[model samples]
Target: MSFDHEQRRPADYAAYGSDIDAGLQAHMRRVYNTMCIGLGITGLTAYVVASVPALASVILTPPLFYVVAFAPLAFLWFGFSPQRIQRMSAGEATRMFAIFSGIMGLSMATLFLVFTHESIARVFFITAGTFAATSLYGYTTKRDLTKMGSFLFMGFMGIFFASLINMFFHSAAVHFAVSVIGVVVFTGLAAWDTQYIKESYRYNAMDDSANARLAITGALRMYLNFINLFQSLLSLLGDRR
Candidate 1:
């Protein structure tokens, strides 16, 4: 009996390990799928707003434009507040994310205004490829990314302040530097976020509701990374209209 129990223990452990691996994969797939849907919504919204002269005239104009520009920030601050997140159902979270994606699209409609369509498309592909490779590295690499993520976060904050200052100075040099640094920061963030999301599955997998919320939030993080990366690369590589 002792020998038989010992033999079964190893198989039980192996089966448990396999279950965990499968769960993690499914969680990651959910995260990626949600992120892709958000991206699609944002892209479709941006294209529609940019292509329609009536929509552009209203949205890209002064007062409404400010609303469009800051709406996503508003949602992030108020909609995703700690209390709100705790109470938010999976359905509500999904809807909120969708709305935020559309608002981001409105803000990003300026990209279409500033860059040629062909150049935008080209730079987008470049950004996509770069993001995928970096995220894959983050997912597969055994090395801890927590330290690297911390360093990159500080760099990101520096550039954020630098960008605000440049808004007043209108310095081309600062703009160029920020663009370059932004690309690097956001690209690194993509990897860091992927690793974070991958690791978070263990805790979140116990509850369906928790896992659903995690997927939405994870998607939002990755979506932001992709968007920032695309914008930074576009500024550096895109041809203006």
Candidate 2:
């Protein structure tokens, strides 16, 4: 998918370009709105689970806790992947996104149990501000972010492996290092995903179903960036109760 500039454009082209720009803006707004709603659901669900001992007992136990932790991964693979979700209609994708968001919230409840509310809120705002800044840069910049996407993905994989090793080793230093790298990787990812989503917009396609699928996909990407960024910041800066 490429957009080429002739450097010397025609009058007709500019008029058509204005219409496309409006469509792209509208599409981007939908993506962001959907992402915000999903985040709200996740945050609410997490808080509720954390506050209720009965829910916590059911969810936070050894076997169940493991399931809760891994469920979101399962959802991403089976439920939210492009091969599956792209084939899905707008309603179907929205429902799947909602379910995945809830699963993510269940996984995140452990954070509430482990950290103070004040610290969580503080780190969340920090992540939000950082995400907003980098994502804006991505959207507005003329430079392509495509090259960095693969490298950032590799960094994410490295962090993943280091985290798994640290889980067994119980190493604070390793964990701290992982958190730092995670922040960097996800920050880059926020920018890369934004640019990717922005560039994906085509001037010609106006199919509502296709647009909806794109919006859901974009929402999922941004949601992931926000959640991971918040978690990383929490690990680094959050004070324990």
Q: What's the lDDT for all of these models?
A: 0.87, 0.88
Our model 2 lands, by Cα RMSD against the true structure, at 4.6
Candidate 1: give its CA RMSD in angstroms. Answer: 2.4
- Compared with the true structure, what per-residue lDDT tens digits does model 2 show for residues 40-138? 999999999999999998999989988898899888887688668789999999999998889899999988889999999999899999999999998
TM-score for candidate 2, please give it.
0.93
Q: List candidate 1 segments past 4 Å from native.
A: 1-8, 81-86
For residue 146, model 2's alpha carbon misses the true position, in angstroms, by: 1.2
Write down the lDDT that model 2 would get: 0.88
CA RMSD, predictions in order: 2.4, 4.6
> What's the TM-score of each model vs. the native?
0.92, 0.93
lDDT of 1 by residue, 1-241 (tens): 3687547687797887788789888988988888889889998899999999998999999889878887887888888643465578989988888888898898899889889999999998998899999999999999999998778989889987998788679998988999999998999999999999888877666677887788888888899889988988998999999
